[model samples]
Target: MGKIEIVEGDITREKVDVIVNAANSSLLGGGGVDGAIHRAAGPELLAECRDLRSSTLPDGLPPGDAIATGAYEIKKVKWIVHTVGPNRHAGQTDPQDLARCFSNSLHLARSLSARSIAIPAIGAGVYGWDHETVADLAIRAALAEQRERGGIDRIRFVLFSKDAAAIWSQAKLTHLGR
Candidate 1:
């Protein structure tokens, strides 16, 4: 089994079995992680995503729900999981949805037999979430899920900024015991 890692780095730079993209429900290439992943993965990634956007999502790409795609230049990983994140809100629903995102991604990674996976701080950027709070929820959810399935040995929270990284670092220390 691998281990949980809270690292300060770029998602594009991480070499893992799969990287989860904090994407919109549409699953189309847009700003934030979606744009970054598309930019790094090239136009072919958009080409593949086009079909998902055009076709009707019978079950709907609800928040916290994830879908898979083939990996591009980003090395080591064979697949990328696109999970929808909750937008900023003053209600408990947002946190609940955010937690579901982790759950869904973990499930997908396990189903794919992926031992190493990386994820961004979901809902902490454009979504307008407080970094520390979201970090606690995300880390706790990931750790709890790990304890249950024992599938994802390496689960990483790849932060884009030093501030975000520091928040995760503190949260990991205070909650997950580092």
Candidate 2:
């Protein structure tokens, strides 16, 4: 199985093959992790997202699905995987939908032959999912993906706050052990 790590750090600063953006359905950048990633990656990233809307993903990225884009100016990141988590406030509370965000991101990372990836607390922030639930879902999805497909060797869950890191760490231990 691939190694899973819980880190208390900024996702934008990760030196990994891929960084997962907890994006909105628009993929045009919003608050929290999405805005930070777009700002760090610069205008090119936004342009690419806009181009995606104009072309292939005209309907915007759907929740639980993922799409990859160039990291642009974000140092040490080759690709950015954008995923829209289910918004609890919108009454989209299916656990499977939240789980798909992690699984799809890992699937895309493995397809790209990414050795490592940095992901954030996808729906826990503004999307209104509880930290404990998101943590469990994230860990479960990552482990499932690892078991089914093993190309992606490292999964680094980069949490912004200590509380989130602690939650994810505990979930990691529960699901993956020490």
Candidate 3:
């Protein structure tokens, strides 16, 4: 089974096999986690995103879908899996859509043979999802994937704030009954 841990820090600096970016549908880099990952990964990341847009996702990546790109400058990370989470007020009110972000990212990571991945709180930032909901959905998705697939070794929820970390920690405990 895969182990899940909550870490309070910047997701951009995580030294893992893959880093999950809570990206917008554009996948061209927006505010929050997407911008951070793009910036941290340097201009090469943007260039790659542009290539993806021009070739594959010309209409832009849709919510609940994920794509992987080379982690050019981010130290110790091989790939950056970008997933778009549902925007609640923008008409994407389905919790399942939010959950799909994690599942799709994990699936992409597994396809790349990634052993460990660091993920941020998808949909909880500018997307307007509540912290508790984000935490619950993220943890549940990870745990479900672990049980159903059982390939990835470790999953880390890297929160940018102490408050977010606390919420994720509580959710983890609540879900695991620990």
TM-score of each: 0.89, 0.96, 0.96
Encode model 3's per-residue lDDT on 17-125: one tens digit a residue: 9999998888888888899899999999999999999999999999999999999999799999999989988989999999999989998898999999999999997
lDDT of 2 at 94: 98
**Overall lDDT per candidate, in order of appearance:** 0.80, 0.91, 0.91
lDDT of candidate model 1 versus the reference: 0.80
**Clash tally for model 2:** 0
Clashes of 3: 0
Q: lDDT of model 2 at residue 1?
A: 75
What TM-score, to 2 decimals, does candidate 2 have?
Answer: 0.96
lDDT of 1 by residue, 51-163 (tens): 77777564447887888888777767788999877877644355888888888888888899888899998888777788887898888877776787566888899988888
- The C-alpha RMSD of each candidate to the native structure, in angstroms, is 2.2, 1.2, 1.1
**Candidate 3 C-alpha RMSD relative to the actual structure:** 1.1
Please give the distance, in angstroms, between residue 110's alpha carbon in candidate 3 and its true position after superposition. 0.7
Model 2, span 36-149: residue lDDT tens: 999999999999999999999999989999999999999799999999999999999998999999999989998988989999999997899998999999998888777774
Q: Which regions of candidate 2 are displaced past 4 Å?
A: none
Better of 1 and 2 by lDDT: 2
Q: What is the descending TM-score order?
A: 3, 2, 1
Query: Residue 109 of model 2: what lDDT?
Result: 90
